[model samples]
Target: MHIFLHQFADNAAFNLRRLLCAALLACSVMTGCARYVDKPIDAHASSLLAPLDPQQISADTKAHPSTLLPVLDIDPTGPWNDMQIGLIAVLTNPGLKAARAQGGIAEAQVFAAGLLPDLQIGISADHPDSVGVVNAYGISAGFDIAALLLHSATRAKAKAAAAEVQKNIAWQEWTVANQARLLARRLPFLQQQQALATDAENTAQNLLGLTTQNVDAGNAKLDDLALRRVALLDTTERAHTLARDIETTRLSLNQTLGATPEQRLPFAAKSIARDFSTLDANSLFETARSERLDLRALRDGYQSQQAETRHAILAQYPMPVLTLNRARDTTPIYSKGASVALTLPLWNRNRGAIAVAEATREQLRIEYESRLHETRAEIATQLTELQRIATQSELLRQQLQQMQPEIQALNNAVQRGDVALVTYETARAAHLDKQIAALALAQAAAEGEVTLELTVGVLLWQ
Candidate 1:
């Protein structure tokens, strides 16, 4: 009886220790650890798997039935258009590749959340300093009662967080895809502008040469020669600007397509224009709510926050540490028993964590609401701007058509030397100005439609 009572004291002391220590000990024993391995970084940029050959790829896919493209449920590979470039961008963007790697961590967290808590087993042995005392041995096992009971909340939180990660990745892909499409759309417009600029520059240069000859021969006014020189300088400036624009846009396109800055992929096709008259504002708002990937990702984040709030509330409950102990002390004392340790702090029952979780949930809700509002406002603004551009472009084209007869007559008069050089120069400058303005408006309407597609989370053109 004395042996059992004395052994109880030793075993009780073991059970008094925090389950946290047992947990650490359990982790160290049940799992093996290793030194860190070296992972070398490759600083060199990697090229894409294949060069984008839109025409050839389209032909091959059709000619060979066995060569099928990936079915991502958003197939844009029908006509070798901008959308095809968008698909390639989503598949190959280097930044997106790095973003996708983060998903693995979320998956691992979910796996860990589902795992059961490990059992902690501890053992001790003692040798008597004096000759009379017998050898002593003690063994104890501990389990975390709270972790086992509250596992469902932890798993739900992890699963929701993983879902949020996946949604965020999808959102990134959507943004990258649209960026590639927009760059492709802009490329053709820049090319058209470049041609106009080059033609204007050449025209000015020729006119200035003729004016200089006429002025030296006393056949034209010196003031007329000065005006021609000014016109040449203006056209030259415009040409230089357009050249830079073309080069910069080309570089941007390469970047969007995940190619090196200098690697120009000669695959951009003319972007088909969308009729803004057919687009309904009400319908666009609905589409944005339902299909916007960022909104969906935000919803996932909010749900994860919901799980976190629940878990935080559950954490307030007392956690019981169950311990089973067996021991043999000096002088024939022995013990075998079990114990349940309830840890409850009256001073604070996880109020701080619960408060933090609630506040965070509210912040996320507000962020999502603000983002939705911005999406709706932006969609409406782009639609209105596109309508205005289409209207002005139509009017300008009609006016330019009406002005064509006079321009042709003026050209005929100049050829026969029946008009002042200044008269034709003025007419030419006005004509060029109107033509460039119309082209700019058309480009704006086309690119605005692309922006609208991004805002509404729908493909507006092929």
Candidate 2:
């Protein structure tokens, strides 16, 4: 009975020890994990600049195809909507792709910069043992606290800069898409003008042929026939030039859409409805000032510089280093020691470095102010120009409407054989010129609207 009791006590003690060891091991693991608990400041700042996950980036890229184009649901102008044409440019433009990639790259840098520097290990050995000399082995491991703090600051700045750059990139891409859409809309009108010119030339040629037949029959003079032929040839040459100009315009539009130089896009033939009125310039200027990406980027840059300056000033203070050492000798000697060390700033007070940081910060401040001023001026200028163009366009439309009656009167006179061929031709040409001018005025008005809208951030490209 006694032996059994003793064995049982022994087993219980062993179990207690085992439990204690397990508890200790668990506590140690927890402590190691807790070492990574970020400070409140770091946590707050890091939260503000969380890196975009791979999945989120992929999703954004995928969503672009649907949203890149603008949808004009009310317009029944066939499959070639404004949105699809805009998408063709946004999806294919290499500049936009590169800008987005640059943003991603910047985001990666921010992630990298957030990480602390790695601890390094150094090892050395020496032996002077010709006849029983001593041998030594030394190892050292250390972490750079300054580097950690500086790197964190650098990462924060980089992140802010990257975000600003991304905004600019997005704005630029949207601007490019807007320009392409405007050009696409203009293509149909240009083609219409070419067709009109061709018809005028054909009409003139028919008149010349009639005059030549009259001369052969001795009913018309040779001089009159020659004059008619010269007029017809001139009209034909003008039509040819107009065709060439249309081709050039088409090539330009194709290039903007990322198509080959020789490639042509088959746009839907439609006329722009002239129902749009002038917008408030003052309101647009205010919106642009508030939303312009370049200005936002400049503001971000200024803030980042301020952070760097603070960090630089903070660096003047030296960090305390703690070192522990242990040594063992084969001759039975042993030693161990721990020491705290700090660098002295007796001669070099870091004044020069501080001055440099202050100067740089001032420069950044000036630059930011300058940028703000420039942005405001540009917005005002663009707004004024838009207003001017809108007014001119309205005037031209009025002129075209007033000229239509005279042109009709001349046409009726020619049909009734009450006017000479040249007089009728000249009147018709003048009317066509007025029509061309009206089309040009309409195009200019549309462009002005697009520019104003874009500047004010009413629309965005993918």
- Using all chains and alpha carbons, the TM-scores for the candidates as numbered come to 0.83, 0.71
Give the range where candidate 1 is weakest over 10 consecutive residues by summed lDDT.
65-74
Per residue, candidate 1 scores C-alpha lDDT tens digits across 177-267 of: 7777777777788778778877777777777887888888898998988988898899889888878988887788777766667655655
- How much is the lDDT of residue 147 in candidate 2? 71
Q: lDDT of model 2 at residue 292?
A: 68
lDDT of each: 0.76, 0.63
Clashes of 1: 0
| lDDT score of residue 343 within candidate 1 | 64
Evaluated with lDDT, which candidate comes out highest? 1
How close to the true structure is residue 377 of candidate 1, measured as C-alpha lDDT?
89
Best by TM-score: 1
What are the per-model numbers of colliding residue pairs? 0, 1
lDDT of 2: 0.63
